[model samples]
Target chain A: MTKISAEGICKSFAGPRQRVEAVRSFSLDVREGEFVCLVGPSGCGKSTFLRIVAGLMEATSGRLEIHRDAEDGRPLNSMVFQEYAVFPWKTVSENVAFGLAMRNVPRKERDARTAEWIDRVGLRRFAHHYPHQLSGGMRQRVGIARALANDPEILLMDEPLGALDAQTRTVLQEELLRIWQSRRKTVMYVTHSIEEAVLLGDRVVLMTAHPGTNKAEFTVPLERPRTLQTTTDPQFSRLSYQIWEELRDEVQRSMEENA
Target chain B: MSSGGQRNRTREEDGKAHTGAGLMSPAAGTVLLRWVALFVLFNGAMTVLRLWEPLWWAAALVNFVLLVRIAEQGALLVPARFARTYERSLAVAFPLVLLAGWQLVVGAEILSPTWFPPPTRIVRALWELATGFDEFTGTSLFGRPWEIPARLAEDGLKDGAAAFTAESHLFATLMRVFAGFAIGAVPGVLLGMVMGVSRTVRAMVDATLSAFYVLPKIAIFPIMMLVFPNPFGEGPKIAVVAISAFFLVAINTMVGVRDIEPVYLEAGRNYGATGRRMFRHVIIPAALPVIFGGLRIALGTALIVIIAIEFVRSRTGVGYLTFYYWEILSPDKMYAGLVVVMILGVGLTTGLKALERVVMPWRRDPGRSDPGG
Candidate 1:
């Protein structure tokens, strides 16, 4: 079953001097329970495309649809922002339970689900602590737990681990794989890291620089239940390097254009 | 303090070889010589201070300047044991030194006692005013907190509260600040929210709001009086304070709303939050830090406006007491009233800070200085 279908979606911003095209003719069809990674350099509008799918932004011209898959009437999609957009004013459990509260879930049920997600994120100890009290990695965990607790049909992540340190990023990547393997919600993950793209995505969708068009797609041949040790596998490095080879030019082009 | 002593010990050890080589090296020896000269000048000034001559005053002035310069350099050289407490030590020390200087100058009769009564005289007057009720004016400095129970016993709770309020200038000022702040802040926040969310409303009111914001609130007092049925009643006085608080809160709340990160709003919308839910869970909480910041400023403004109003037109309040003392040529009592105002300001501010802690529990660290906290 197709979870999300996007055809010729475009996004443009009006600048003081000219109309800047952020994303142009972007198209993708994501399958239910499939993990798809949109890989690109900075300013490539992979995030913009994700926002469009999440209905946070409107596509200039296209047909975009998200199939509602939850029997319990959950939201269509929930996005984990790149900046760990957890409310600094709310406790960890409160942030996790926010969507449930908004959905008018009962107090007992909301607390139960919130507690469950908090434990899953390994933030049970810091459940009553505010976002400001948590580290960057822990705060991002709260952001992830928040989206997951919402019980959305599709999980849209925009570089969720992008701000974290390399060591923390690897740990979270394993945690993410562990959670996704168990739940298998339709996921559209946007990132600039090719290694991350190959390590996580069942299908890696490469985006170009300048106007952010669909450049290429690589289907990962790696099996599920991937771990930190999986990155050391010869196949993993080979896939990562191959994708890097494809992405190297666009990365250089973006840097040059920015310069 | 320990670090300062340690630094001094290290300096002494390091400078042992460099001592008494003043003209040759012009380094540590020169600093030592400068300190010696500073001490000599200070002692010389102290000797001159005993003289009853105008020429000695010039020498004293020069000595004071030299002492100030050396003290500034000495402060720079001393290392702090506890950074926060060390800085606060200077704040405490400067005021104490100023008070001592005032005491000396007035005691020595260099300044007239009528014009500038010494700190001791002010404290004494403050104590007398606090303890004794004036039969002529029917007021006491503090409403005599010690006598509150006795008054309550004699007059029942209702009359006791009224009597206590009537007797206390500080209480009167505080009541005005609280009433006016509430009257203004609630509507100010509402209007600000409306303006923040709607472009049409913002465009319409922005100019007029800015104009009113710039206008001195005191200038509108006559108009406030006209609007109220009784000009000399509490209504006009409160109206002036409310107007001042209103402009400050409205402007600050508007800015707070406008400054909220769009990402949070987007996230809120994505998670199925709409209308009241969005305002409660997202918008209001997001803007709270800024709104509280505005409230703090509004609080200070309310105190200032209320005091000014009291000075011009009221029979009660700390401001009126100060002006009344001034009218009767009692500078010490006037100083006591000024002290009362400071105490009230501090007390109100502390209350606001406590309220902030309750409202904003997520701000774990009270001070914003420590990013790591």
Candidate 2:
């Protein structure tokens, strides 16, 4: 079953002198429990498209539908943002429990679920710590845990580990794979890293530079339950290189457009 | 690679040598000795020649600089383990040294005792004011704390006994400050939050608020008096105080709300936080640090306005007491009242700090070790 169906999505912003088109006629279908990564250059509007799907931004013109299963009490979607948007004023457990609290889940269940997610993210000991008290990687863990604990129908991630160091990013990618394997939640992941797109996604969708639109798509040939060592596999490198070759011109075009 | 290793080793040695030189610098001892010698020489010349009065001031300034440098050097000598404690003690001791110097200057007849009263005399006056009631003004500093229970017992709760307990200068000033603060800050924060969230509201009121914010609140006292029915009573005084605090807190709260990172708001909305939930979870907490900053500044302003008002019109406040002693030409008692004001300022600020700590546990210094990793 298709969990999300977005067609001809176009987003534009009012600039000082003209209407700046951020995304143009983007169309994609995410299957239930399938992980899809949108790989693009800077200013490709991948994040804009994700935000439209998240309902944080309105598409100038589009048909977007998130298919909800009947009798499912979970939310339509929950997003893990690029900035690790965990509340600095809240503790680790509190931030994880935020969505549940917003949904007015009872205290006992909230605490139980919050604790489980905190432990899963390996932040059990820092449950009472604030975001400032945690490292960048640890903070992003809280962000991931916050989204996952919400138990949404579709998980939307916009460069969730983009702010982390390379080593931390690798570790989090493995953790993300491990988590996705267990639950098999429908996820829409956006990233500028082709390697990340290849490592994590079942299918990688490439986007154009300015006025971003779907350019191409590729199926990941990597095996499931992947880890850091998967990157060493010959197939993974070949796929990543192929995606980079397609993306290289788009990155150059984006730089020129920005200039 | 070998050359790189040798270069690194040489740099490490140079760093160590620099640190060693800094710690045992020969100039440190000579610097202090030079200053002390200059100070002594200047004072000796002043005493012997009985030079110009301006030259005496210059010698005194040299003496003051020498004392400060000595203190700084002395602080360096303290062990690292007790460094913080030593610094705190020096803060207290430096003031005491200044007071002692004042006392010596007065005792030596360099300064008139009547004008620049010694610290001991001021302390004595403070005790008297604290303990004794004044028949002329019908006021006291503490309002007879020991007799409160007896008065209440005889007069009962309904029959004006509460007035006796609230009769002191300190009590009057405190009541005005707290009442005005509460009255002003609550509405200010609400209005600020509204303005912060809504750009239309902010644009509409920003100019008007800025206009009132810059006007000296004390300058509007006459207008406050005219607005209040009982101009001579506490109404006008408190109104002025409330107005001052309101503008400060409102402007600050608006800024606080406006300054919240947009990503947090997006996250809040993404997580299904709407309206009140958004406010409670995301908006309020994000803006709290700045709100508290505004509150602290507003509090200081409130105190300043109240003191100035008391100095002008009121008869039952620390400001009135200080002004009264000035009128009577009792410098000691005036200094004592000033001391009480200082104490009140410190006490109120400390209380606010404690409240800030309670409200903002997340802002506490993160000294905890990473137990997870």
Candidate 3:
């Protein structure tokens, strides 16, 4: 079953003098419960594409469709932004319950769901604390819980762990895997990290630099419930290295062109 | 505190080492000799001015400032044994020293006591103003809060007689400030929120608001008087204050709204927040920190405008009392009225700060530990 499909999608940004094409001729089909990671260099429009899918932005020229079986009293998609975009003014529990509260969920049910998500994210102790009081990784956990508590049909994550330290990133990667293993919702994850793509995604979709379009796609033949230790596995290293080899040229070329 | 003392001791030791070396550092030696020369010059000038008599007070004031500067330098040159205690006491001691100097100079009869009354005279006038009612001026400080119970007992809280118990200049000024602040600030915040959220409204009003914002609110007093039927009544006074507060709060609110991070707004939209819900939950909370900043500024502006207006027109406010004392040639009572104004300013600001804490529970002052649940 196709959860999301984009055909000949294009996005262009108009500046003062020139209209720069951000993404051109982009097309992809995402399966119902598959986790697809879009791996690309900076300025490849991976985040632009995700925003278009999440309806935060409109595609300049394309037919993007999200097919749903029936209304499940949940939104079509919820986004986990790169910057941990959680409200600093709200407490951890309030941030997690934001979506439910916006949907006008009953107070008792919202509190229960908020508590459940906070507990799942291992932030029970800090539930009443503000985002400024928490670490960067803890703040991102609030962002994740905020999205998950919405019970959306699909989750759109754009470099959600990019801002965290390496140690915190590894910890969150394992937590994300364990959570996804239990839930298995369709996720479109965008990242610059080849290892993160390989470690998290069931299918990795590669994109080109400048006027970004689909370059290559690979399927991960890994076991379920992958842990942080999975990154040290022979196959995981080979797959990550292979993807990096494909990406290294584009990354250098993009950097040179940008400079 | 100990660390500060240790640092000062090291500095003094360094200074001593430089002096101990027969070749004293030219700069340090010059500074020490200069202060010593200033100390001698100040005393010599004070003695010479005392002999001269009439113009001696002016010379004494100059010498006193020089003495204070020399003392400050001397204090800094030495290592502090208890730096924190010394620093705390300096605040109280410095003012007391100034007061004593003032009393000594006035007692010497160098200047007329009429124009320059001593601290003792000011204290006596302040005490009288606080406790007694003036039959001639028909005004009092605090409406004599001490007499409120007595008045209540006599009048039995009937026929508005109890109101007379607390009808002082301080109360009058406080009432105008609060009434005007409330009248102007509420709608100012609402308009500001509207202007903040809507580009069209902001564009329409931005120029007009900015133009009026820079204009001195007191400049429009005559217009305010014309707007009200009773020109001599409270309407015009409060109107000026309200106008000032309105502009400050509205401008601040607009800026606060405009300054909200786009990411927060996007998150709110993505989470399905729309219209009133978005405003209440996301927009309000996001802009609250800045809005509070604006409110504090608006409050200060309110006090300034009210005092200025009272000085110009009113007969009942603290500002009027200060002017009234000046007209009657009572400098001591004038200073006493100024003290009341200072007290009012501090009290009102403290009240607003308390309100800010209640309204914004999420905000934490740096270095203050959170009393966590």
The best candidate by DockQ is 2
State the displacement of the C-alpha of residue B204, model 3, in Å, after optimal TM-score superposition: 1.6
lDDT of 1 by residue, B120-228 (tens): 9999999988898988878887788888899899999999989988998778887899999999999999988888877899999999999999999988999999999
Candidate of highest lDDT? 2
Q: Deviation in angstroms for A250 in model 3?
A: 3.4
Worst 10 residues of 2 chain B by lDDT: B23-32
Question: Which scores better on TM-score, 1 or 3?
Answer: 1
Candidate 3 Cα errors over 4 Å, as ranges: A256-258, B1-116, B153-158, B365-373
- The residue-by-residue lDDT of candidate 1 on A1-259, one tens digit each, is 8878999999999999999999999999999999999999999999999999988888988889878756787888899999769998898998999999888999999999999999998988888888877788888999999999998889999999999999889888988999999999899999989889888999999999978999999999988788878888999999898888889999999999999
State the C-alpha lDDT per candidate.
0.86, 0.89, 0.86
TM-score of each: 0.88, 0.92, 0.85
- Native interface contacts kept by each candidate, as a fraction: 0.61, 0.62, 0.45
Docking class of 2: medium
Cα lDDT tens digits, model 2, A82-141, are 976899999999999999999888899999999999999999889989898888899999
Local accuracy of candidate 2 as per-residue lDDT tens digits, B320-356: 9999999999899999999999999999999999999
- Tens-place lDDT per residue, model 3, B1-373, is 6895696477567766776574335544466677679767766875776653665656666766666655555555444586666567777877787788778778877666777888899889899888888787677877777766787787777733546633688888988999999899999999999999999999999999999999999999999999999998999999888989999999999999998998899899999999998898889989998888888888888888898898899878888888889998889999888888888888888999899888887887443234221
Please give the C-alpha DockQ score of model 1.
0.46
Candidate 3, RMSD to the unseen true structure: 5.9
Candidate order by decreasing lDDT: 2, 3, 1
Residue pairs clashing, model 3: none
